[model samples]
Target: MGQREQVATSLAAAVGEEIGALLAPVDAELLRHYPGDPATRQPVHTVYVPGDTFTAGTVRSWGDQALAALDEHAPDAASLAAVLGLAGELAEPVYARVRAKLEREPVEDLRVDFEDGYGHRPDAEEDEAAARAARLIAEADRAGTAAPYTGIRMKCLEAPVRDRGIRTLDVFLSGLMEAGGLPGGLVLTLPKVTYAEQVTAMVRLLEAFEAAHGLAPGRLGFEIQIETGQAILAADGTATVARMIRAAGGRATGLHYGTFDYSACLGVSAAYQASDHPAADHAKAIMQVAAAGTGVRVSDGSTNVLPVGPAERVHEAWRLHYGLTRRALARAYYQGWDMHPGHLPTRYAAVFAFYREGYEQAAARLARYADRAGGDVLDEPATARALAGHLLRGLDCGALDPDEVATATEGLTRADLEGFAVPRPGV
Candidate 1:
């Protein structure tokens, strides 16, 4: 070979080796966990009730009660009409639609709380509660009235309550499995998580449970409630949300904000501990940043201001609930808590209105951007993804019909929309 040819060949070989090195298989332990798909069932809100009050039919009953209350309080349907931004003349139709939706599916997620909702009980009473909860779970499963997402919220694992909390969890899981098997979409909510160790310990317990019951590893996932100031920041002054998720050993599915508890931790007065408080906003923003690409869902806290009392007073409650829910939606927190049945109407209304109000403009922008037919505007991949996600979310929550979404997206199929939803490289 000529000298020039030999040098060129050697350089090409060297370049090939460099490229191969770059593409080499990553170390098993070093490879970061990527939460694939990100398209799981996302509930609009979780209805939390005390364990003693929980039953297979609890959520359905709540829906019925909510509908009856709406009819009785707003016989003229003015309250719903106002919340939905409809004219007085259109109130009846809109109220009917919301009423029908609640009747068909009253709750999307249900958390039978053994924490604050259940309060502290005697040991025998706690055991009974766990057993009752398990029977209810079986009943709900048999009756098919269980929400798509259902779980129990254990008492906090803080020093004072750790033993009772774990015992309750054990009893509940044991009774549940013996009755039948784990229910569909079962997730445990570990409330008031204040350290990474608590999460690791919880994961260890769950791992043990799976082994003892002959269940698949990772079958049980849990959500961490960032309810205290310590949960947001570790003792070292570093953000601890991601640490908590990692500690769960890939069993953490979500990080739920707790408005009142967090606010109280921050020394906010009871009256000021609200969904829209600046302190709550700061905490949620921290959670958003921490869980951005981790595949862990983020949920806002609930609005404690429920719609109750006389017909005239109920309107104000509806307004407050709707406003708070809309604020959470605007901040991109899709899931929250609903402590009362009356909050149901505004929950659906807010979600529907959010999507309906932006559908036309979002669709047009997405279409133009996809076709590269920009006019008096610029678009990027992030913008495109956001627009696509908005539509997908609307569809997921029953706010937007599949046919309408397809039409709006210029005939894009659900698969196409899913493809669009795939995060860009390094996102």
Candidate 2:
């Protein structure tokens, strides 16, 4: 067999064995909790809705509204209704309960460096030791002592690791780990990812900690913060990232677009033009080029402006956010930050719309191809050659399979595949 084919066969076996072993118990537990279809992978909409919405009277009323919304909009009306029914009981203590419950769940991703700079001192060297200590203690307390799937963005590199030299970065991060054990799928967001060296340094520290704690090497994954101009300018930027992940023993989770910092780097004027500025677009494109086909996640930076206005304006604002967000998600970026709960619904709307559109178009194209090509057919290279490339180019930004491509090309020819081209939007 060819080397490539041999390697693929071995890798498939390894993955199959690992998956069977890992998922067997998971399947059992899931079956106990869920009678059928286990139904994981629900769309996660990070709601930043107003705290007031959860007030004693408001929660019940909102629950009723949510139930109605689910009845109308949710694909799985019965399941969503159950979730909303429980959500209605969340009232006075809903905030705290929600926060705590979130902290305890196996969330796919959790970010600590909120855009508002909510959790850190303005100046790193400032006397925030006592405050830092207090913060750790509180988070530990919240651990009730159980750790959730979460990650923290520590003080900036120049920032003091601790008010006292005694509380070093390693010590602080270790404390967080001890407070609950590193979260499930935990990833540290390394802000201002300027060079490969910075990533190497963090990886080294994590290695040391893992050894000391008897943890697996490379357990901690990293999310790059593309905020600094230097990061964008690094010669061989994409190559540098690839090297860093390899050096770190394959613990790269994703790269995040840091809008404000990127804008600041470009000297962009006016807060209104921050996120969508040409500079930000350039930076995002750079990151995406590096991240393509890596299976690593990418997230756009947050919308700085909060939606706080009359209901109509609020909906309008949501529509705007939805359009922008839809563009990002449609381009295959899955996660983005939400600063307010009110924008939460917009996040969902944008993502769902984009995916729905992609699915519809792809489905229609495949159906047409199927109607033309009869029977359990073999690959008609002629027809495929005619349309495959076009269909592939037209695919939405996500995982794609050879089958999908073949399905889309059902009765085309080599000439057709050659002629088939889906020009990217705006050519």
Lowest-scoring 10 consecutive residues by lDDT in candidate 1? 27-36
* Per-residue lDDT of 224 in model 1: 95
Report the Cα lDDT for candidate 2: 0.49
Which residue pairs clash in candidate 1? none
Q: lDDT by residue for model 2 over 1-427, one digit each (tens)?
A: 6666433343667889999998898876443322321112222322222211222222223334433332333324233223223133222122232322222331223344422254444444323432343244345346443222344455444334423222334544566565666545344666666677777777776787789888887676767777877776666535455454444445566677877877877777656555567887877777676654443456787776655655445545655676668667656555676665455444544443344335434434544554564445444434432234324433322223345544544544333433433222111
85-137: candidate 1 lDDT, tens digit per residue: 65554455446657777888888888989999999999899999988988888
- The lowest-lDDT stretch of 10 consecutive residues in candidate 2 is 34-43
Off by over 4 Å in 2: 1-108, 114-116, 119-149, 159-180, 235-247, 360-427
